[model samples]
Target chain A: MNIEWLSFLTVTLVTLIGSLSLVALYSFAVRLKAIAEDEVRGAGLAKSGAVVCFVLCGCLVLLGIYLIVPQLGGSGGH
Target chain B: MDLTLIVVLVIALALFFDFTNGFHDTANAMATPIATGAIKPKTAVALAAVLNLVGAFLSTEVATTISGGLINEGDNGFSIGPEIIFAGLMGAVVWNMLTWLLGLPSSSSHALFGGLIGAAIAGAGFSVVNYGTVISKVLLPALLAPLIAGLAAYLCTKLAYWVTKRPSGLSSPKRGGFRVGQVFSSSLVALAHGTNDAQKTMGVITLALVASGLQESGSHVHFWVIAACALAIALGTYVGGWRIIATMGTGLTEVKPAQGFSAEASTAAAILASSHLGFALSTTQVASGSVIGSGLGRKGASVQWRTAGKIATGWLFTLPAAAVVGALAATLTYFGNVGLVLVAVIGFGVVLLIWWLSRKDIIGPHNGVSDVDEAGGAISIPTKKQRRKMRKRQREAERAEAERMARELKKAQKNKKKEANGKTKVPTASGSKSRAQEASAPKREARGTKEKR
Candidate 1:
């Protein structure tokens, strides 16, 4: 059988990066929120940083949704 | 007219299969969130159902080729009729129901493909199947998808825990944040499931229409067909496959909010990425793999390998088992309408029987997880605390049983010594009254002597 090794590799790479980054970003956001709540110094900055991390995570989720729905210019041919 | 009736029956059966597909896979997206208490069971299923309804309207590109190039549908290939499709649907439905009852998260797509392949072969020899496509597309992906998703989830889980780790004295962040993240990630998985799976049924219905000459082969799916399929699936999702949900949520592994979030994110990412790359994988397998990976990633968490093994076994058997059932159903169709009616009767009867059996040990939203304990450790792997409790209970029971046996043994020994000394007599029916009086008289004499002393 002619297995598409290239495609397989691409999927593995993309899934790892995509999922790991998303989880990391969300974790970072949670950490920031905790820091903001626990400490007085730089609380405002930490809270804002948490917001940024959350926005990034949300964007990644949107990107995922974009890839799933074909009408939204996705190549999901399942 | 007869053909029309047959086509109608196939469409109806296809819709029912779609319903099963929805419920069988509800655990794929909702299990983690529910298990972690990120979402209530009823609310989680409701959200999944709604998302699935919306997702069914998202794409129709793949709906035109639901077979995924597994069947030989070219002009020179064997012509597959509506009857064959009917038989295939029956096989898929039966297999799906059986797996759900056993609470194994097998692939609905595999069941569908296996059913079609089996029916096609039974109808027109083995040449009608593309074994290469089966191997490359279905088999290979099945093996790889879980591994990739698991690795991603494992690493992601470690990262989540590391990032969230706190200083020596301060408390860790409330898992409420991770719970919120889980809600979104699980929702995405649900939406993706709806988009991918609902189309398969729509495609089957459209194929039946085209085969019966009611619609053009290249034309778009009918709106009514899409709508009916969407509703059927949504209803099924709302009903929820609580049994499978219990297995996935609590049986395979213990899921905390952090692990739940990581697992869901990995599942959503893997599914979206694979679909975007046109690499088809079973959503059920991906989710289960993620859960297992998260379990391994957590420092103290343990995966229930027995449960995982059961799920893997189900996956291996899904295709061949469904194919056998499909072949049997197709073989019956050779006798024409009488055969069709008979297949229907037998199919419905089996469905009813399964439903009846399920009721004997019902699993619903209220007691889904609680009931898992009795279904076998393969369906409900006890948590560490639960395992400890069970072991303690087992030890206590063993001690109690030992004490009882010791007491019984001592009593038996005492009775044997008495009989050897002739101090105890075996009573005969004729002398029973005299024996009882004699025994009492000795006891009275002993009491009198003790009083005099």
Candidate 2:
């Protein structure tokens, strides 16, 4: 109900959204991987997309960790 | 400083409860993954253990809610003492062990809440508990979390199938992909579990610290409290809850890779959302519901509804059972020093009894998976009648097999004797001796096994 509570709530929301996006990117990466073996002209495009999504997913998880960390949240995280 | 001893005891009890909580709920995160063979059971737990340790440090909002919001610990002059908390913890831990013995994934959070409520009501009267917070933060979420997670998982499962579907309506390649995806999704659930479930103990410990006047009201969890709690939970997680895992993984429904992925993802989302909202819901209920929903989502998949019903019954009983024990413990403690010692002694006895009884029907890797499905999710040592019947049937089969082998050996001997006698007036001693040995070998082997049995 106060600023501290509000900030915690905000952090929770951010992390929730972040997790969902990571899953979505994972799904995209899987699709790209499925087609990476294709010999078609689009194979290059698929490979790049897969790499980008995997990288993004990894970054999202790290960001989530950073956001949840009390030390990184300046001391009012409770 | 008379309270110092009691405060340390309470903190130790809180950490013990946290350890039980970790193992009890490991099924929530890793059950589906283990069931689907996305990861080996041992490896899955190790992964979950590390993630839970990390997740425990994620947020303290729920911990604050527990310490300050649920039980009346501040200004109303009705401070909950360490003695009451200790009794409550004993209540919670006993219920946890009972449910685990039955392989039921009941809510540890509910047990804790119920124990505290009962203890508080007994010690300080009903006015000491903040009923509004219990209703909104605990009860409402308890009722809603499973339903929401179930619905989400059901829809997500359908989506998974649809996206991966071919003209034949089967997604074989996609199945392999999802099995790999299950590792990630389930790990997320494990991390989410640590963030949510471990905090309940932190909150309880913090509450006890406040009651003993060791910490200020409205303060964050102490660093040592966080570290100890995280370690307790992580170590417990590493040990794994194979009984509950067996029940959730194979007893409730047959989990495929896609279903596993969907269920894990849905569970992670619901738990994370609840944790963020500061709702102390049971992750077990959410995970169980998600699994059931996924089962129903897939076409032609059958749910062991009887097992599901039993689990539901356990969930309904969890709160009241813990509360009753809590109340009794609280009443015992009311008699002062002797009563406190008596409660601890009785609690220790009960814990040893449960553990001793559980050893009779150990659910290790060999028998854990196979026994659960047929027993409707709750596997204990087979009853005397059932075990006797099994033994009788096994003996009958072995006897029948041995008799058949004996008959075959006799027939072969007869044929050899006729052939030998037909060839010469007197059979060679060496040939007859070799034949006798060959004929006796199989019979001897069969006799040896029968005697062993």
Candidate 1 Cα RMSD (Å) = 14.6
lDDT of candidate 2 over B63-90, digit per residue (tens): 9889988886546533778899999999
CA lDDT for candidate 2: 0.74
| lDDT per residue (tens digit) for residues B13-118 in model 1 | 9988888778666766776677677778878889999988987887664465453355566584327788888898898888877766665656788888788779
Taking chain A of model 2 alone, its TM-score versus the true chain A equals: 0.68
Model 2 lDDT per residue over A1-78, tens place: 122345334434443354346556766676677667544778988889878987887787666556555568633233
* Clashes by residue pair, model 2: none
Measured with C-alpha atoms, the lDDT of residue B171 in candidate 1 is 75
Off by over 4 Å in 2: A1-23, A38-41, A60-78, B73-78, B168-173, B241-252, B300-307, B364-453
